[model samples]
Target: MKTLLLALLLLPIAAIGDDSRQLVKLPPAAQESLRQEMLDNLVAVNEVLTLMAEGKVKEAGEAAETKLGMAAMGKHRGKPVDARPGPHMPPAMHGIGMDGHRAVSEFAAVAKTGDRDKALALLPNLTSACVGCHFSYRTR
Candidate 1:
């Protein structure tokens, strides 16, 4: 059973075949910045989930909007960022990234209204945008 579970977990990585995904060639600095941003985005999503669980809808919305939504574009620590990753990305990948940000912004709007259920329902859409981009592109 443990082996089966391990294999199930590994399946997605195996499925993300190098040949199938587009390789995004970025400057080393830009690549590292992108990696950090992605990690931060994951953490922000988790934070939002935790806030939602605590019925802190306003806080969750603020976190989402400031961390992963449109408000986050070209900014880190609420300061304007110097590294611009979009210019290095292919147009399709850039669009996917924008869509993901937009989705988060939309979810934040609903979350700010304190309609937890409505906001939660939109979570999948934002996550789907993330998943789609990860599945289709790689920066390695």
Candidate 2:
């Protein structure tokens, strides 16, 4: 029974290893779209970091919210943008839908009043949701 249980657990691990070995095959257009999405998201996130560092927290929060919303909708150039696998994936971009919505809402509350400190304080929590999502899901 113990051996059977151990085998059952190891079976999924072996399957996952095999899956990882399989090359990720995407069409050229899809690959380009994925690359662009990653670049755009990185730019947006970097901008937010800059704003925060400059103590322009309100602006940062607003920009973050806007970028996050765009990411969540997955609409780039009138087409859908999907998440990319591996390091190309931005943690923040992975959190779409409800998670993104909540983060934006929180950021907005602090941003509306142009409160730099408050906005800065909210940034980590917002970023954390993104991190959580990325850790939980795998992109194709």
What TM-score would you give candidate 1 relative to the actual structure?
Answer: 0.80
Model 1 per-residue lDDT tens digits across residues 1-140: 23223333444775764556668888776677788888998898899989988999888989999988899886533432335577788876777777778878999999989898998887664575676777667887
- List RMSD in Å for every model shown: 7.8, 9.6
Each prediction's TM-score versus the true structure? 0.80, 0.56
Off by over 4 Å in 2: 1-32, 70-74, 80-97
Kindly give the stretch of ten consecutive residues in candidate 1 with the minimal lDDT sum: 1-10
Model 2, 24-128: lDDT tens digits are 445556667766755776787788889888878777767877775433443544654433232234433333334655666677668657887777777764455
Measured on C-alpha atoms, candidate 1 has an lDDT of 0.75
Residue 41's lDDT within candidate 1 is: 83
lDDT of 1 at 92: 69
The numbered model that scores best in lDDT is: 1
